[model samples]
Target: MTSASVPAAFPRAVLFDLLTALLDSWTSWNHAAGSEQAGRAWRAAYLRLTYGCGQYIAYEQLVRDAAAEVGLPESAVRSLEADWLNLTPWRGALDALRALEPHCKLAVVTNCSTRLGTQAARLFPIRWDAIVTAEEAGVYKPNARPYRLALEKLGVQANEAAFVAGSSYDMFGTAAVGLRTYWHNHVGLPLVAGAPPPEFEAPTLDSLLPWLGRFGLRPQTI
Candidate 1:
């Protein structure tokens, strides 16, 4: 893509899952738990709680509860909050976002509180068209509200945009709202049983541009 070029308009917007898709949030959790095993357990518990709870629950409270469910101490929760800013982007996240920046609208529909979602989204340095948090939507995903809220803010229908999902659990939400999804399955987690499959899945974002190209994301003349 060059300055004389622009993206085709079919996919007018690209929505992302900020925490897991864009950032290496797993590392932060691992550090907070003092071990990868404990972190995985705690994070998995957190996912189940959020996705199954349906309605809104304080995001931080869910985190603390997840820690306890996994037999982790309150100190783990303290460490997670204290080291939140230490979260970094996944490899190639910056490049992928930068490539898409001038091409189409970019937004985030993350399952987090507004404060934490805003902070995590800022790590990108890209001007997001919108950032819809679970708190704002009054429900955690795999509920459809957060994704629908983001689509509304972007002013595009579900078919006119694509969702980048970090967790397979997102398959339920995106499908419910009729949004096509591309799973950035960087962690190699298995798909959720009975969940809809994404249009594409990869260990990294390297294929995102090419995949978008298939949907008329080519460059346009000035």
Candidate 2:
């Protein structure tokens, strides 16, 4: 089946996943660890601790735990954590957000702690309408609480907004909550078994603007 098309009407707002969709955490990890294997290991450890174990630890703690799990030195862990505070935006992410800003409200619904989320937001060039962190919900994603909390805070129904995520698991979680989901599948990963698929898929954030435009939701021209 083809990816779901955008609705004829525009959503009231767009909710974005912070880590991979907006920020290039993997790039920073690779840069710090000096190997792709090290970066992947740290991410795996992080996913295991957060999604697999259902823990809501601080983002820094996750970094520390992952580093220890992968046998990284303290200096490397410290540098990685520092890099998180100044995460570089994924290519086209900032431009996409800026283009969409005036058309609809934009917010970050992330699985990061409040402190980390706040720091990450400061790095963004655009101001978000709302920011909902898992720290406030007491749970990581795929649990429904974080997604529901974001809907509540945005004053929008699940169907009134679209949730953008970069991972298949996150696509499943957001879809379970009834939001129209978009997957930024930059790496060409397959959907997880038994997980709900996203309504739209694009190789990069920049590509979604045209898809939205087809549904009469084009970005406002300055």
Candidate 3:
């Protein structure tokens, strides 16, 4: 391809947070909790546990621990596990992804076990260029490994890529790894205190493609 046809307006690769940014794991968590109130609290606890632990830990254990911390029973954990496959894609997520696919390589950097992470990723119809899980990286997000692992797999430097973060906590890791992030704040969660802000923030993935248009020289399919 000639320089004039290169996809210069967009990064060469875009990495996404699987759980929050691409899929709606929240509904399944709430369903497992038997109420939205219980589900939200439990989910929050889980995030706290994952973000603080730094190194790898059994992801399911964290879920159970978080449930108990929020007064949920063991059954909630079971329910969540059983219903894990039911996690839905956020509205417009697929469309936005399809739009970017021709112009950029796509991948996911999620905080999940290899089993569940692979399963959750299969829910999407597209073939990912890379799928980096906490299990695979031996560390969770906000730690540099997972994000860097994805970048390594994509064969791109951090500056050559962008991250679509589902949670504000991702800002810390992505920044440390030198990847510009676009916070897909679909749930309206607050930014974590002391974390860097994302390059862009939106309630839905619809804005992702448009925001990406502002970068690089001119976009052509990669």
Candidate 4:
């Protein structure tokens, strides 16, 4: 959709996907694994396991399992898991979050377990309105349950919230539940087949700031 086609008012709340959207966890995995290919494989393996199980698994355990699947040593797996404790924010992620915080409610709805989600939040200080993990919802993204739960927690209708996702898979899930989606397409990946396209797209978290004006958002004085 064109920028002018965007709604004139911002959603009452903003839901964010935690892993890649807010934190640079993939880069940490790549550094620990010593190759980008291996890091991608590990993430793929982790998603396969998470979806295959149809339930929440702690991200650290998922990391260990992915390490095993990718034939990484125990030491490397440990390092990868430890990296979650101090995940680096994507460039301009914190600034973007800070800018948006006062304008609307902000929440994180992630595929991670509650422990990992909490740890990630501590690493980056934002007063989130809600933090919903798959573990709490008893299901993962693309399932509809977690997204619905997030909407419930935020006390907003689907149309009254916007979901910002780092992956097309997540965009599909968020859109399926009828929330406006903004895809953070840092890698220039094509949209996933069989899923609806996101309502908005940007190369980085900071790129979304200027576009918020289309939603009629203004900085609020706390």
Of the candidates shown, which would achieve the greatest lDDT relative to the real structure? 3
| RMSD after Cα superposition, model 4 | 4.7
Model 2 Cα shift for residue 141 (angstroms): 0.8
Query: Across residues 45-112, which tens digit of lDDT does each residue of candidate 3 receive?
Result: 99999999989998998998999899899999999999988899999999888888888999999999
| TM-score for all models, in order of appearance | 0.93, 0.86, 0.93, 0.87
| Candidate 1 residue-wise lDDT, 85-111, digit = tens | 889999888998888887779999999
* lDDT of every model, 2 decimals: 0.88, 0.76, 0.89, 0.78
Candidate 3 has what TM-score?
A: 0.93
Relative to the unseen true structure, what is the C-alpha lDDT of residue 201 in candidate 2, on a scale of 0 to 100? Answer: 82
Error of 3 at 81 (Å): 1.1
Candidate 3 Cα deviation (angstroms), residue 66: 0.6
Give per-residue CA lDDT, model 2, range 36-118, as digits (tens). Answer: 88877877777667776465777667778878888987787777777777688889888888877877788888878898887
Checking candidate 2 for backbone clashes, the offending pairs are none
Model 2 misses residue 209 by how many Å?
1.4
Candidate 1: where is the Cα deviation over 4 Å? 1-10, 217-222
Off by over 4 Å in 3: 1-8, 217-222
Q: What local lDDT score does residue 68 receive in model 1, on the 0 to 100 scale?
A: 97
Candidate 1 lowest-lDDT run of ten: 1-10
Candidate 2, residue 66: how far the Cα is off, in Å: 2.2
Question: lDDT of model 3 at residue 189?
Answer: 90
